[model samples]
Target chain A: MATTLHVTLAGNPNVGKSTLFNSMVSGKSRISNHPGITAESVDGFRDRDKDRLLVTDLPGTYSLHLDLPEAKLCRQHLDQDVEFAMLIIVIDAMGLRRNFQLFSELTQLEIPMAAVVTKSHEAQLRGYQIDLELLEEQLGIPVIGAAERSDVRSLEIDDLIDGARIPAQIPAQGQSIEQWGTDLLAKVSKPVHPEQARRRRLRDDRLDRLLIHPILGLTLFLVAMTLLFGSVFWIAQYPMEWIDALFGKLGVWISSRMDEGALRGLLVDGVIGGVSGTLVFLPQIVTLFFLVSLLEETGYMARAAFVADRWLRPFGLPGQAFVPLLSSHACAIPGILCSRLIPDRRDRLATILVAPFLSCSARLPVYILLVGILFPDRPIAAGAAFIGCYLLGAVAAVGTAGLVRRTLLPGRSLPMVLELPPYRIPSVKEALRIAFDRGMSFLTNAGTVILLICIALWWLSNYPSTPAGAEVTALRESAAMQSDPIEANSLLERARSLELRESAQASYAGRLGRWVEPVLAPVGADWQLSVAVLASFAAREVFVSSLNVMVGVGQDLEDPTSMARIRGSKRDDGSALLPPASAAGLLVFYVLAMQCLPTLAVTRKETGGLRWALLQLTWMTAVAWILGTATRSVMMAMGFSG
Target chain B: MSDFPIEDPQFWIVTLLSISAVILLLWSRNSSKKRDQGGSCGGCKPK
Candidate 1:
């Protein structure tokens, strides 16, 4: 029987402990330049010569003094986890003074440990050449040098594992942590090329002036974000279309092969449609993670956080919340996941809570539809309203974030103490691995739930069948007598339209729509619009299709005549289907509502509770309703006619 | 062939499979919920 060797990798934030752990176990824990991106502990195993090494990588922490989330988690693992056969103190050679304090604190645990110095090459280049043999002698434990920028496989990891022993001396207990760090720092940091060290510091300082400047830095950050998200949307477009077409063809093929029945319709429209709806967004998700991965690997992501911190701090969000908030513009699933970068539990939760308020790409089609209705003829005005929709969502996200921090969270954002990593040429291979891992993770978690929900919704919309009514029967009879084929086809289409309308009105989902109709009346909506609004909880983009179906419009949402048909329709009370005020209000609602089930699912998963997900839903829905109603009331008072 | 969908064997088979799929999903979700030690956004930050 092979014995198990319980090993752990521990370090300060940004010390590249994860990279070394990956090397040790050939594991794929996502690595980033941002501090504490590993918000959780994970284990990996390796087999060596009749023994199996179970390696746990603990979340990195800078201090035990603060009640920070990462620090608390790390403390719990070290104190309470299974007795370690070995603890690897992974410290950075480049910033030994800064990183060594955590090492000092861990010595109190008195576990068997060895030291591995990371960023060795970076230190040497800047003139600090750490002598591993001398330090190994001083600490009386095995030590090795590992450079993160190098091929980590070249590390003699097996030897390091075999050499683990309880150190003869722990970092001195009496002196302050900083003083101890500096005292040890003098013993090392031997000047190899002292002049180069000055030059290196000078270079970094000069770069920092522009990159993290208050005004210029923020501008650069925004520009970089625009380019990043722009590319995500633009580049993912082709693959998205391909996925759409592929699924469409698959549905058609399934429909042809299956026998005519409700089962076939369910498979084609419910199952396949649901899967495709989720899968079609995969390209956008992949692209967003890919570009962000590249930025993170290049080390600019840390700097970007610093640049955002100045503006975000006043709003009770840390700089780390910037990436997640901006990412929400693409999709809230990854945005909520990215909240792991944040250190405080409350700040992270607040970011996750308000992230869905931002208008994700899912809202774009709804915007184009409603904004088009609001300003039909004036192209410039339509374009401005489209831009205004995006701005409104952004304002809502920030405002909600501030409100949440003050009330539910009840604290200003913890002040940021940042350590900007030196920028490097990003590795495409590493970026691709990070992006792929995140993409697969998304598919496994959010996609499955979305598919199931879509199926359920599809079933709700179709079941308890409504038989053909009087108008539908009359139209069919008229079509039968028409002599010309074209005229016959027109009559058949009219009959189909009436049947759809009747069925939509009588279906369970339709009944739910009617149930909510009175509540939505103040927002300038009747039963049909209420049904669309209710169905959109599945996904905001579904609003356009749901409304179209409820009013008996054709499948082609982009068709001008279909849009015109929607505009020309009326309510049961004989009022216009969507007056100018109502359209404006609906636009506002789509911009602010928590309408994506996938996002809520991810929020629950990320926050580790159903309470947060429910809170996010309640708060955003209430905000959207109040604002939507306000918009309609103001517009109505302004005398906007149908 | 049966006149009604419910009477058809093939219809019943497909319906059974769909219902089973939903049950399996619920079962899987409940199982994972129990297994969760509860604090990771799926990895990278130390537990």
Candidate 2:
């Protein structure tokens, strides 16, 4: 007695399929700027006339016959034994011929269908008028013209739903699908006059000339990236500081309320410390995602990819590889997952193998820590050094890709071909939504993983607890005797710091670090650094917290004074713990090392074999160690002391 | 107060977190394997 209709919204990539889906469903589904952003079908429902119409947004694919995973997914969903009331194929009006080709193929399914032509406004702006009635007649289906507006409810989509209720008749045509598509286009659409066409072309060409020009485009790209990274460093500082202070206060509060015991140590030093280290990077992650979303929405990402393609092709990477590589800067998992869009298997593999070389947000805290130590007074130098690390990673990725292409996956690089979507002003609301989603997902997903690791590490370093020695007791006793309040507080702080450091040295992690010190010594790592590096294998950002735990600095690195104290920390031999050479070496190592277990698990799963993952780990670790050792030697030879 | 001195608040918190971590890890691994078997794009095929 209940009427529920199943409908699918399908279309070519970047033809406003997601936008229409969002508008129709009222932002019920995820929408982003890039083509193939939705790799899986998302379902939403609407109530119409006492009946429910369930709309499913399928992944964008160029053709049902294409071998790619997205194409197969589209085909699989379409072939599923569900009684569909209608299939509304969304097409871009500006690109009718190519879009119609898909519609012609869809006709073979023999399902009740309607066609919705989006981007009509863009077409009209270019002086072209599409006859939806003629298109309806030619295709024997209801054709609706939907302008690119935010309000999908205004587009009379209900008429489309109603029209789709009627089964479409497949017209018997002598021509093939391609010919039918061309014939239908010729009959139903008229292009702008020659002069008007020239004018539109001129406008597009003028913009393209600047955006895709060799020297100017590259320069603009560099400038844009510099500003982006600069803002990431500058803007994220405030929120990062707030988070650090909040966590610090929480730790102090807990310490005050609880008596000194294993429970107190675990709460203040283990749990809070670990969570704070990773959470502190949230502001930068949010900023990066927000800005990247804006760029993707503005249609600039396509042009930037186009430019990068020209430069990267000789390095054996196609332009299409640029998106995944760029996305890797956020996190390599999504970046590797996004590689499904690349048509060629070899190119995709190379992209996946080398993507982790890009310095992800996980590395941000480590970079800040070491850079802060290396450049205590020079913020400008620190910023430049930060940018330099990203560049180093990117260069290493491209170089590695080139080598792989030449040796293992030997083949000529595929020539890049891409469609540059019409430029539009980015929507702030959409960008903010995407940024929030990404930030939350990062916090929830990576946060859980990091939190567990942190607790485990805390337990590792805390248990088999060491008792306070004679010197620590003496310092506490002396602090109690000091009459001046300031002096007394300083002495108390000293006693606390001494006790923490002593306990840290006696911990299991400290013992392991001491065991591995000789092996890491040539790379300028002390026992503490060795412990931190070893612990960081679980996750790169863990290095900061592990180091904090090892050095008894507590968990708040956001405070300038705390960071300064960390920078001034010395080894047992009273030598500077992080000299410029050693810091540079560590930075290089972190940049190149395949230290993330999650990334390896993802790689093994993505590449469909542990072989590639093993190769990636072995190759990256070797490269990182060799390069790091060289950097240390070179810096030391140059007399660059801390 | 009670005979079970080690079963304090800190003990419970750490225990809860560790148990949650183990459950999450197992759930994630199982789900990832299922996704792979289902031919979802998220995971690689077993060679």
Candidate 3:
């Protein structure tokens, strides 16, 4: 039997821990460039002849004593009774003093360990050098320099294994850990030349002056975000149309092949239509994550957070909240998860509570639909409205955070202290990996949730078979009697649409919509829009699909004729189904509402209590309702009735 | 009321599939919840 050695790789954030892990593990584990990516301990094993080495990658933390979640997780793992063969402490060569602080604290455990100094190339470029042999002798361990090198196999494994098996000695106890780290760095690491260090600092300071300027930074941020959202809307449209057409053809083929029965309906309407509705948003999700990953890798994200910090502090949020809030634009789950990066409990909670207000990709479908209806011929106005939705959500988030801080969780935000990493050209490979991982995760996880909801909604709007009215029956009969094939087909299409409308109205969803119609009437919603909104409670993206199905659009939302028909749809009182005011109201409502059940579930889990989740849901929904009604009222007052 | 068709194979298939999908969804959600809670630093066991 082969001997199995368990080795733990620990490091502070952004110390090339992921790079070393990826190189050592042979692409077996997921890797990302940003800090806090390793949220859990992942185990990977390598077998070299008779020796099998098991490696565990723990979450990055500056110290085990910090009150942060990552710090606690590291402590838990370190305190476990299971003996490890070795602990490889990866550190950035440029920041040896800061990184050694963590090493000094780890010495208290008396664990067998070795140090791997990474990024030596960058450090040496800045006129700094390290005496590796002296450091090894001083620390009484095997210290290796692995700069810009990811291949662990090239290193002497036997030396590390032998070092691990040696008895560890505790450091002298007189000096504090910080003092000990400072003393050790003085002995083994040569200092950079004062002039060179000052020059580098000057370069960073000059860039910071521009990047963090109140007005300049905010302007750049807005321009960058506008381009991002604009690209998502414009570039993703082609693929989205293709997907929509594919699903529509699939449904038609399925319906044509299978007889007009329950199975066919279930397959065509429930399964295919429901899944395609959510999947069409994949292009936007992928593009957003890829671009964001590129920014994070290039070290711009930290700077952006720093810029946002000064602006966000008045709203009771730390600068660190900026990353999570920006991430919420992709999906609120990851955004909530990333809130772990915020150290303060109150700050983290406040950020999490308001994150969902940021317009996520799920709301894109709904926005595009309403914006299309509201401004059919005006592309520039439609684009501005799209941008306006995002800004509205952001303003709402800031206001909500301010309110929360002043009342329920009143406190001053902890000052932001962050290490701004050196900027480099981001690796395209890493960005692609992150994009692929995020896109697949969304499809597999959120896709399942959306699929099930679509099925349930489809079933709700289809069951208890309503008998067609006399008018519809007569229309169908007259269509059958038409001599011209094209004219007859058009009549048949209208008859089918009428039948679908009647069946939907007679179904359970329609009845529920009617019951809730009065409450929504003030917000400019009739029963059709009300039904869609009610169905959207499971997920906001479902609003578009549900409305299409209920209105007999049949999944081809790209068809201008069908879009015009849906826009021209009427309520019982001959009012437009989605008038300008109602469209605007729904847009505002979707922007503010906490309509994602999964987000609520994640909130409950992340906050470790149902109280916070319930409070978030109630508060966001109330805000949405009030604002939605206000928008409707203001629009009506402005005499813009459809 | 219309007669309920217990003998129909299509009916049984739809019921079975629907029940399975619901179970799968619930199972996925439960597992996801567990992963989120268990992996969270806040929810980690106090040392």
Per-model chain B TM-scores are: 0.62, 0.59, 0.63
How well is each residue in A127-243 modelled by candidate 3, as lDDT tens digits?
677888888787777878865533343566557655752324434656565776778778987866858766876887787788778899788777776776666566666776677
Clash count, candidate 1:
10
Q: Is the docking of candidate 1 incorrect, acceptable, medium or high quality?
A: incorrect
Per-model DockQ: 0.17, 0.15, 0.17
Per-model TM against the reference: 0.76, 0.82, 0.82
Q: Write down the lDDT that model 2 would get.
A: 0.73
lDDT by residue (tens digit), candidate 1, A64-130: 5557666777777777656436799887887887776676666667778888888887787677788
- Cα displacement (angstroms), candidate 1, residue A596, comes to 6.8
lDDT-superior candidate, 1 or 2: 2
Error of 1 at A81 (Å): 7.7
Choose the strongest candidate by lDDT.
2
Model 1 vs truth, CA RMSD: 6.2
Q: What is the fnat of candidate 2? A: 0.07
Ranked by lDDT, the better of candidates 1 and 3 is 3
- Candidate 3 Cα deviation (angstroms), residue A312: 2.0
Which 10-residue window of candidate 2 chain A scores lowest in summed lDDT? Answer: A553-562
